[model samples]
Target: MKKVMFTGGGSAGHVTVNMALMPLFLNEGWSVEYVGSAQGIERELVGSLDEVNYFPISTGKLRRYLDIQNMKDPFKIAKGVYQAYRLIRKQKPQVLFSKGGFVSVPVVIGAWLNKVPVIIHESDITPGLANRISIPMASAVCTTFPETAEQISKDKTHYVGAVIRQELKQGNRDRGRNYCGFHKNKPVLLIMGGSLGARKINEAVRAALPALTENFQIVHLCGKGQLDPSIGVPGYKQYEYINEELPDVLAMSDMVISRAGSNSIFEFLSLQKPMLLIPLTKQQSRGDQILNARSFEKAGYCRVLEEDGLNDASLVSGVMEVYNKRDEFIGRMRNNKHSDALSAVFRLIKETAKHP
Candidate 1:
């Protein structure tokens, strides 16, 4: 059977697109293997799948800030690169597919050393540190946004939009309402702060619960270890995280309030969900979320409420505005012809693997 290896980690965003592509590759009779850090969330997610070989490798985070860890990280990264080089030489996979993350850098370099062709996908408007490092080594780079393609070498860059999980489109609204104990009479509001949760967004939403619950039933995914037991109001429900039930909940939601991660916003666009986006500020991140939010707002798929203006009152008003203008937002989202790019991505993978 043909074989391909996937490498990505650090956050769920880096791994989700891989998950969307894996099943398609498997059904086509390719042997799938994964390379990631031993202790990352990717281990649990990828290891649970049948037939996919999971290989754990040493990894060190790439941080822009100064710290003692920075001094030691270079050595760790060097060791990781050597270990990945040996693994790639031994596995001899036909091609290496990478979703950019700190862990992916070593793997991409190792693949280059082994003379294995590599393909990478970047989900942001601009390349992250990892992708910037991996781009020159990759045979091709796939991007979610057209503007992102312009930033890279035209010969290698492909603007293929986003890959959304197929199961997301199979959600049942009735099942979603039952899962959240919500009635069909009122509009449902879904608030998510990515996988790790956003403290500012959570705090503001909790503070505005009383006013919010009056008009809309809410389902809040508050991230791991961030759930509060004190707020058990009638129309509001809280969860640390939801996996299988996520599609249902999304199906039942009339409006969404979320962080502006590219993978998530594209999923919302595909679902035609109107959103109120509160992006992570420069203080918290490299301002990628802010850029992602601005792009979505410009496209009319969502409304942006900056972190500086995210108090309870503003949170309530922003959500109300999204709810009121939902139709317009949905109309704009429906016009996104490139919302589902799985087919294009799959074709590229096949073509790349054939030469490799």
Candidate 2:
């Protein structure tokens, strides 16, 4: 049987695209393997899959700032490269598919050293530190944004849009309403703060909940350990995190208030959910979320509310604006040219594996 290896982790965003693609390869009778940090959330997610063989590797977090951890990270990364190289030599996978995270850098290097073709997918407008390092070594670079393609060599770059899980598109609205204990009378608003939860967003939204609940029934995904049981309002529901129920919740939502993670924003776009995006400021992130929000805003798919501008008043106002202009946002998303990105990515994976 043919074989393929996937690598990416750290955050849920880094692994989501890989998760979406893994089943496709498995169904085609390919032996799928995953390389990620031992205790990352990826291990829990991918290891649970019956068909994927999960291999844990050493990886150091890549930070832009100067820190003492930076001193020891090089040694860790070097060890990761060596470990990955040994694994690849033994597995001899036809191709390596990398979803861009610090964990992926060593895997990409190992694949290059083994003469295995590597395909890397970038989900942001600007490449992350990991992808920037891996791009030159990759046989091809697949992008979620068209503008990102211009930054790289044209011969190796492909704009394949974003990969969305198929299960998300098949959500049942009635089931969603029932699960949330919501009635059909008021419009439902879903607020997401990415995987770990956005403390700023959670605080602001909770502060504004009284006003928000007056207009919309709210379902909040507050990230792990961020939930407050004190707010037991009739029209509001809170979850620390959700998995199987996510699609249903999203199906029932009339609009979304979220952070501007590219994978998430793209999923919102594919679902045609009107969004009010509150991007992470430069202090919190590399400003990738800000750029992701701006691009979506420019495309007429969502409204942007920068992290610095978020507060009780602005949070309420921004959500109201998105709810009011939802039709316009939906129209733009319906006309999006890159809706078929999942298929494009699948084709690229197949072609790369065949040629490799």
Candidate 3:
């Protein structure tokens, strides 16, 4: 049997993307294995799969500042690579598919060094640093945005759009409403700041809740970090995070307020949900979120907001504007029903297996 190793972690975003493609791999009779950091959210997410083998390695984020922590990066990379080499040897996978994050860096490198073919999926308008560095070693690169292709080594990328969970392959507005406790009279505003949560966006939403509730119900995914019952605003429900319930929350929404992380943005787009996106700006390494937000805004799929200009009033008005023109905004999303990336990725895998 063909053995396929998948690497990614840090958030459900990465895990969900890999899960989206599992059925196709199974149909092709590929033995699926996963490699990611032991501590990331993927550990729990991966536990549910049957007959799947897993390998854990140490991986850490690269901070932009020059600090003593930077000194540990090389050593971590070496240890992770060694751990990954051992894991890949045991699994003996013929191919490795990576969704870029710090967790996948060593896995990709180890796979390449072991002569295992590597395919990387980058889910952003600009490639993540891990994927960017792995481009030279990758046998193939897949992307959600065609624009990202230019940034990679030429001819290495296939624009497949972003992969999304199977649940969102089609949208159910009523199911979404029911899942979020929609009363049917008020619009539902869905807000998420990625898996870790965004303090700025959460604060702005909390500050604006009084006005937001006047016209809509709110289903907020506060990333566990912002789950403050004390900030409880009527007409709003806060959850630390919900892995299995996202489809229902998204389906019931009239519009969304979120960060511009590629996974969230694409999931919103796939569901045809209108949104106001706040791109992360504090760190230089976060440039991709800004670019991803701008790309979607330019496509007229969502309204993009910069954190610098954000406030309770501006956020409320932005939501109102999108709600007022909801039909037009959602029209862009409706036109994107066939934007699933997995179909194209599977095709690539099929061809690679034959050629290799």
Please give each candidate's TM-score.
0.96, 0.96, 0.93
What is the per-residue lDDT of model 2 for residues 92-194, given as tens digits with 9 covering 90 to 100? Answer: 9999999988999999999999999999999998999999999999999998888997789989999887889888998989999999999999999999998
Whole-model Cα lDDT of every candidate shown, in order = 0.90, 0.91, 0.81
lDDT of 1 by residue, 30-62 (tens): 999999998887777787678899998888989
lDDT of 3 by residue, 1-356 (tens): 88788998877767777877766787777898898887788877787777677778888765567888788887887899999988887778878888878888899889988888888888877777777778888889998888887888767778888787777655567776666666888778888888878787888889998899999999888885578878756678888787666777777787888888887788778778888988888563558888888888888898888889999999998999888988998887787656647788988876775675
Collision pairs in model 1: none
Model 2 residue 269 CA deviation (Å) reads 1.2
Ranking of models by TM-score:
1, 2, 3
